[model samples]
Target chain A: MIRHVILRVMAKMLIPLILLFALYVQFHGDYGPGGGFQAGVIFGAGIILFALIFGLEPAKAAFPPRVLEVLVAVGLMIYGGTGIAAIVKGGNFLGYGALSHDPVHGQHLGILLVELGVGITVASVMSTIFFHFGGRGRKDV
Target chain B: MIDLIHIFLFTFLAIIAIVVIRMRDLFAAVMLMGIFSLLSASLFTVMDAVDVAFTEASVGAGISTILMLATLSLTTSKESTLYQRPRPLALVVVVLTGAALVYATFDMPRYGDAAAPINHHVADYYIARTMDDTGVPNMVTAILASYRGYDTFGETTVIFTACVGVMLLLGGARTFYRWRRREDAGDPEPRP
Candidate 1:
């Protein structure tokens, strides 16, 4: 692998911008053309870029596999927990009407929370998969 | 016009697909697949599905390409020279499937026909009441996260399952457990 200083400097500059764009996509899905999936993938791509420019060990230090596994599970919980909340509130499974007093507010809150869950899971999983596949057969690993 | 753009995209897509098939080099095929994804993403955007387009472009052009490259690094960069003839049965099967798919397209509703079955279904209700029901301007988000929350949940589960499966197949589970055991013994952790 060619370790070019110019590539290193450019990656350092671009990483933060990429992550910020991902956040925008995450929260802006409600009013525009983005959502958890796109945001998550973008964020994962950013981290992957960081790993590519730097190395696998540094990337793992930044985001550990253990933490990623937990995050993957947590995202699913956030999604499932929302449905359970609705059921507890005397609504049907996955129904958001009972989430708040106003149906609209309930829907908004539910969507936001669920989308967040999806974003976290997707981002973590993609990164984790990268770690696994890339780390394989490496002398460092 | 949108129709013209769609025609251009599909034409490009067909050419890319043919090139990808003809190319024996795995690396070139992968690159062509990315181009194929880009064209399809453009078509999706033209059809007003910006969300899908964004996803297809990002995943197809970015992470997947990198991962495949990483795989090529681990394996041989060049495809092996196998001078095997094409199977007659496989070609016939592919041709029959293509014909069937083309025939099936005739039954599909025309692009964005308001009178289409899908447009007449729950889509109308969602569009009519999205603001009142969800207060979200993005109907796709409102529907995917709230109205069709169950389906999204299922999709999330599928992703989770796939992740877990990969972890198992890639020995992530073994290493993680071993690392934990080592940590219990107060041993220093080495870089993975």
Candidate 2:
């Protein structure tokens, strides 16, 4: 640890805000300039900042590698599953029209879910890459 | 005013690119690359491509900079000056490519030309129907997530594939650390 009190205090204050902003970007994509890809990177960046300030072990403790690896696959599954779901409902692949009673609402729901899936996968993969990269050459694994 | 901003940003971009190319310190080059990305992101914002700007800022300036710094720490911060010989062939190739690109730009439609061929194609339809079809206010999102859902899915899959590839190569972090430790301990024939 750097023993820099100001750095610690600022990081503590900023991490939550970064994460909240990422979620805002994620769900607010329909109304704004952000979406799943941007949100995921922002979210991963928040975690990376945490790791940078607090050290890798503590950050890994907060977000285990096992959980991150699982989330990576789960996000892709959610995306693919959404398409399969449309097929099951007798619509074309990734056709949001049949996901609900109202076609417009179905589209809305499908977009939201799909964006969520993208966000989750991107976030986890980014964090995983950072973890593995940062872990190299350290005596403690 | 926007044109002035564009010129100013481009000037800075050119300066940074030259400086990055000439810089011998890898750390400084990485920082300059981040600045370059930030400038391009601003340019994208100026052009009303907010989504692209957001992505460029995050992925280009943010994540990639950090990764480069991390890699620098793991390796050397000073770029090796062994390849200092100037190659005339390389210069000729680069100049030819640059000239060709500049020449091709002459045929491009003026910036923000509403009647351009590209705007007349599917863009007009998407712009008109996005709200009705997807009920999303952001046309970019509507097109990405609904109108061109297959493309977005492919992009997501690409990201997933990149992650899987990285994980496969670097997943064995413990093994890597162990190998490093053996090398540090002066083992001539360390186990693979």
* Interface RMSD, in order shown: 0.8, 0.7
Candidate 2 at residue B124, lDDT? 84
Which stretches in model 1 have alpha-carbon errors above 4 Å?
B86-93, B173-192
What is the C-alpha lDDT profile of model 1 across B1-192, one tens digit per residue? 877887899899989989987887889888888888888888888888898899999999887888898898789867777788989999999999999999999999988788898888788799899999889999999988988888999999999999999989886666886788888999989947
Model 1's CAPRI class is high
- For residues A23-60, could you state the per-residue lDDT of candidate 1 as single tens digits? 99999999999999899999999989988999888998
TM-score of each: 0.90, 0.93
Clashes of each: 0, 0
Tens-place lDDT per residue, model 2, B1-101, is 98899899999999999999999999999999999999999999999999999999999999999999999989999988886689999999999999999
lDDT of each: 0.89, 0.92
Q: Residue B52: error of model 1 in Å?
A: 0.9
Quote the lDDT for A99 in model 1. Answer: 88
Candidate no. 2 TM-score? 0.93
Q: Which stretches of candidate 2 lie over 4 Å from their true place?
A: B173-192
